[model samples]
Target: MKNLLVSLADLPAFEEIIDVRTPLEFADDHIPGAINAPVLSNEERVIVGTLYKQDPFAATKLGAGLVAKNIGAHLASTFKDKPQNWRPLIYCWRGGKRSGSMATWLNLIGWKAWQLEGGYKAYRGQVLQLLETLPAASRFIVLAGHTGCGKTRLLHALAQNGAQTLDLEGLARHRGSVLGSFPATSQPSQKSFDSQLTRQLARFDPARPVFVEAESKRVGQIQLPASLMLAIRAADCILVQARFEDRIRFLCDDYASLFDYPANFKTRLSRLVETHGKVVLAHWNGLIDEGKKAELFAELISKHYDPAYKRSSQSNYLRLSDARPLLIDPSGDLNACARQLIVDFAA
Candidate 1:
């Protein structure tokens, strides 16, 4: 505890980051690669707080005992295999007693452990402050297309080839459409989304343009940070062009899991009734009933997605007018297309 304090700026140099906050706090938002080893659990924290409000000295005695027991467990299990020279960065809420106690104990045990100076609060603040100007620093290349155009796939492909790509929907955990929900997977809280995105965005080189798929303000329930949204809207565009049939085929493959949860899919479709009207809904529902999803998908694209995309892109994006077309060939090789895009736009 003497001189064992570190700043958020030094986080990346450390091999391991340990979050000593409660499980819920860690789950809500944490440093991207941090491991959670809570010194005081959620229930224990509440109990200690209540006791301190009631009787300060007695609460300190009980909290000390609990902290010792928990640290023992962590040393025995979590830190059992650590070598003497293993360097770890530890943090808790507000860089208070919790993290201090853990760091002190680990240091006493001969491991080079340092407590985060302002803990998770400081880290969270750094993320917010970093985001304020970070989005403006990097240039963006928007992958613009209608539904089922495989923009996300191509984004990942670009990433695989070492081109900077931000998979927005991947971070949001939704596909950015009416039927965007993934099978049995729940999206993270907004704070968690922000943490992941801030970390992901920071990893990209500011000197290079980042590739990202076009999306609205919200991906499912997760909202994009305002600055990031503005940057994307103002960026250069790469219109991902494929045949209508190719898109439909992509949709069928991409969304095959939706059929497994037929009721959920139908419920999602129902939300669109106000826009498409009852007659169209009835016909689409009938198609679902008759098990003719390909026809339904094709109809939805032609009737719904195409027109909507054209209108929105024309109004919101400045670069769409002179958009460089990145073709999805007959082979449907998105990786090849992504490589070509990187090559074509290597400015």
Candidate 2:
């Protein structure tokens, strides 16, 4: 039993990883790549907790029975096909009885199962710590550009072509602007975002530069890691230049869903009232009502986004003055551009 425990570093040694916390706990967060085989249902957990406060002995008896029943259900379903030589790592919130009971049951049934030390809580601590240190040690290549220059598209292209790229906007599910929210998606909680960022960082090769877009402290409501933001500001930069007309077209296509729901689009535009003033807001809203998406996008870039980019890029990105210009074709051949960028930076 003493040898049946592993730390985070020992993760890759296991053939399978199981999260035995309640469903709600697993939904909140869990170890990356771990499968949920909860030892108690959400309601069962609540019931046991309430009973525990009143009678510890009764709670233990009830919890043990519940855990046994759940584990048996998992065996007859979730684990029924497992081979006898299966090696699994199991965890809960704190390597508590939930995980222990599961591990014990599996071991008794002749499967090799180890418990994760200090469970998800300990793993989360390491994730937070790594978020602080990893970005500081990384070399980032910041992609700087005005709105609708296909920075995100280029990021995807670079990724497909095998460049080490981090799409912060994709992770946050927001585009980093007042009107940046995805049409029907929501951003992850901060804790979940940290887990995602940390997972991406773990996959990076330190010897190569990571390609990321120039962003403010926040991407919509998601705050980037301070160290990463600092690293991006100080790192080498590439200015992605696109024709104004092409940009308007690109934004229209990229944000087509918002235009599909004009009322939603106008509501999003209203968020900029305080920043761009009512006169500008009213004009933008009028464009939405008039169904002039191209014209609306054009005005937005020239009036709002371009000016903001000029002001912020000059101040926020320390190396923008010396940034190398990557001219994307008017046809928007991002794959070709990505290939060139790979040779330029990731090489």
Candidate 3:
């Protein structure tokens, strides 16, 4: 019998594999390296689902017939003239009907096709297991600081300076806050997050230090795997500090469009109030409403971000303070900082 369950370690060797699930299902999560060539389009899947709920026998027969016709046409157009040596792995939700049907069809047409044993679900389980086992040998350096302290920007700079860096927020498409979601940018599903992280990590040497931003257990809707969290906690820290005014300026420019929208501004402010108590919130809100964004930021820094930062900083093994806060002065370049850091660590 041919192998069905291929490890991610084995995926690099196989170049052609088709994910035969609905696009929405594929988007939610999928095996790393599998390209989605969904057997049923989103609309067709919905129609079949409705029929399955209403008339099981009729839906099964009709769905199978339609699926067969669609797959035949797809193979004819896409795989025609291909030799018998052509091989492609196929998978659906559970490696049951959909992938089985497709694999059988490909085999009948003289192609070497195999279906994943448990399909996407099995792949997901494997990913979770790998994540659970990942901490045993990984080394990390967490980029930690208060909100708007330019930690994410600094990570990019460090990457440019030849540090192995994982841009978690960038991968998740989230800024790791209630107000972090940008317009038209949705966070990836947990599955996609794992896939993206795995791919990025594969490029780095585990024996070397990898830099990552300090994050809570969750980044937006997605949660970090437990093993990854353990790795983060065990990692060394490089704390970045900046002046309050600079942080506020960075926040304003970073979210200029959101600040420009009165409704969005109020909504985000309200969320802050809900998080930080009404009395403290009222003061900040009054300052914002009075068009004193600077004052508002000062109050928030003094009341919320600073206190949190102070507590977190006490846990850090290393800290860097820029007298001429880089957030305000673009001249306080990260290149020099990253170089100094690497040399200091090396020494």
lDDT of 1 by residue, 149-188 (tens): 7787788889998799889888888998888877789999
When superposed on Cα atoms, how far off is each prediction in RMSD?
Answer: 2.5, 2.2, 3.8
Rank all candidate structures by their TM-score, best first, as comma-separated numbers: 2, 1, 3
lDDT string, candidate 3, 1-347, tens digits: 33345444555566787888988998898776677777788998888989999999989988898788878878777677667798888889888888888888888877878777777787787777767776545677777778888887788877888888888888888887766876768888888899777667667777677888888778888888777776876667766666767888777667666645656666777877656888876776666666776666666667766786677654542433421223324558677887766555541
Candidate 1: global Cα-lDDT? 0.87
Comparing candidate 1 with candidate 2, which one achieves the higher TM-score?
2
- Scored by CA lDDT, what does every candidate get? 0.87, 0.89, 0.74
Which candidate leads the pack in lDDT?
2
TM-scores, each model vs. reference: 0.89, 0.91, 0.84
**Residue by residue across 1-347, what tens digits does model 2's lDDT show?**
54288899999888789999988888778887899999999999999999999999999999999999999999999999998889999999999888898998899889889999999999999998999898976789999999998788888999999899999999999999988998789898888889999989988888888999999999988889888888899999999888888899888888888868988888888877888898888888888878899999998998889888877789899999999987766665778888887887754
Better of 2 and 3 by TM-score: 2
At residue 232, give the lDDT of candidate 2: 90
Compute the lDDT of residue 218 as modeled in candidate 1. 91
TM-score of 2: 0.91
Point out where model 1 deviates above 4 Å.
1-3, 50-61, 110-112, 277-279, 332-334
